[model samples]
Target: MNKYTIRKMRKSEVEIALNWAAKEGWNPGLNDAQIFYDADPEGFFVGEYEGEIVAVGSAVCYDENYAFCGLYIVAPEHRGKGFGLALTKARLAYCEDRNIGIDGVLENVEVYQSVGYKPYYMNHRFTVLAKRNRAKNPFVREFKESDLQEVLSYDRQCFPAARQHFLRSWIYQENARVLLYFERDLLLGYAVRRKCVEGYKVGPLFADNEEIAKEIFLAIQDDIEGQKIILDVPGNNLPAMNLVKDFAMEEIFATMRMYQRDLPAISHEKIFAITTFELG
Candidate 1:
């Protein structure tokens, strides 16, 4: 039998793990590695077998109270050998004492539950080919650098923790298009559209109502016209579900949002789209 060791991942290895996530059809953002690393530099871990890495996982602690675990993958050749379970256990240990959250793939829900995760809700991924549509909201405009503070303030109401660091990088990522909705100087909502391996994705879409969400969504889609666009919405958000259905987007996949303890207090009503299942 070959020896196996689990150790913290180096910054350079973050990209490798994200690549594996793409291979698994996760469709990770282009600049996800840096933001995730910034969230918890020492949180990602890798399992090595006889000097070759065979598995990876992340337990990124956002604050003392909340942490998210994702990017869990085992090499194709290393499957059925217990590497995945070991890596998961290591990640769980790393996130000890915090309310852990995971966006587990449908098939792996049972596996995660056996390890102490309980399903809170389901998030569905929807994709639509880009089509031009004029946004009628005159108040909608491109995001300005000065709006960062206001955006973060609104974001805090939607997420369980204050992820200022992640928000800074996410909004400024290369080839990203961000937009904000305002009414007479009051920031009503914001949305970000960024290039992904397969196409484009719009996320962290926070809005006060269905009208504002639709306006921001159309604006981003218009900005990135002619590319595929994807969004992940909570199954419980009826307005978000109706918006996707109105655009005729197809449901590509789904994940169960699991937590180790009681769910965190987040304003899901205003969360039109989740930032990233991998990090949140």
Candidate 2:
């Protein structure tokens, strides 16, 4: 008998899964565990085999209408025994009645599709050596606590779902750099840069045009000079593709964005870069 049991993961267990993710070359953020936990405490799940944890997954529900599944991994020694599918189904069941989404690796696309997920677009991860540039935008300024409401409002326009809880932690986390673009009292765009295992990542980069995106991106590099910077851009956004190419960034990774239901209406024109694959 296959004595494998699936259950919600404890807070500490999330860290273990993150370690597993790093070992798998995912390069997760340093404080991602706590932030991910806060997003949905009951979202993370693990499979125990003979009382030894062997598989993990997450079904983080952002709200009643939307959820995201990620971090699905089975122990190397436990692969080829249906553990991955078991964990995946557990996550799917958790997000019952909500539109579930995932940033799936290329190899898992068919597996995800077999279970109702349909590919919508691709997210290409790019990296470049951070160089100090004098690019300056007068409207760009450090994000302040007072800007939370406006930031949320602006972000809602760019993303399909509202993730205020995740955004709050992401913006306020230690060693994170967040910048906002405002013109004549109107918020135009924003970008967040955070330290990662390999270097730093800039994401959730929303802008009205390539110039605004470039200015904010370069400003972030200026703050953390000499470190490699990574950004994951939507494959369909031609201007975003051009933006990275202009900076001489190299494509390092890619994932297909899939959803279990009809794709939600999001302003891809404003989304120069996605927030994070694991959570969105």
Candidate 3:
């Protein structure tokens, strides 16, 4: 076989990587690659065979504690030719024994298991809403570019890796809205949403308290009025579990959000929303 090379991702390669993601039906956030690159500038990678990009992957490493391994893709023509395995190995090698996480396709579990990752959890989407009417929080203002950095920072701590590019675009897109909860000049938490055909959806909502998260959700509803807002909740998180079950929410679909490595234990009590089942 001709020499196939793997190298750290370049800014110019962002389009190709993002294009591949969209082709895979991932429904990735707008400008996902940019924000992802911002968080871990050089974390992604591409594999080339005789100058042709055949595969891509990213090990979005954060310090030595946590990382989210994602964006593993191989061009369709190269599927069974060993590119996918090589790309996966390349990305996973960067994390080694650190606490790494992956939200992967259910069918890929066996293959991932062979690589030393165990299934740690699952995820679900709640879409039904109760009959009562709740108004938006007064402090829940519209999303602004100034809020990008803070949102990214809050998101980074919640996940193993960061996607600064995706966050930047999604937070600022015309169809998306970001609402924040602050306490005494401190950013307590924030939530981001994007317009969807079915309705507006919220993910990556981070807060210090469930009430704060609820306020943010209400604010987002106002921001995108008269639309069905979707919420992705980690099935195992009790607060998220209970809150989703509360008034004005119904079950839609479920998927397993598994992790390869268990990082520092997150406070499930404070985590009422997951960014997304597919992206995070």
For TM-score, the strongest prediction is 2
Supply the global lDDT for candidate 2: 0.90
Better of 2 and 3 by lDDT: 2
Better of 1 and 2 by lDDT: 2
List the candidate 3 regions with Cα displacement exceeding 4 Å.
Answer: 1-3, 125-134, 139-176, 182-188, 194-201, 208-211, 226-230, 242-255, 276-279
Q: On residues 80-104, what C-alpha lDDT tens digit does candidate 3 reach at each position?
A: 8877777788888887776777776
Question: 36-123, model 1: which lDDT tens digit per residue?
Answer: 8877898999999999989998898888889899888899999989889988988989888899999998898999999999998899
TM-score of each: 0.96, 0.97, 0.75
lDDT of 3: 0.70
Residue lDDT tens for model 2, 67-152:
99998888999998988898898899889989998999998899999999999899999999998877577898999999999999
- Candidate 2 lands at a TM-score of 0.97
Worst 10 residues of 1 by lDDT: 130-139
- Model 1: per-residue Cα lDDT at residue 68: 94
lDDT of each: 0.89, 0.90, 0.70
Number of colliding residue pairs in each model: 0, 0, 15
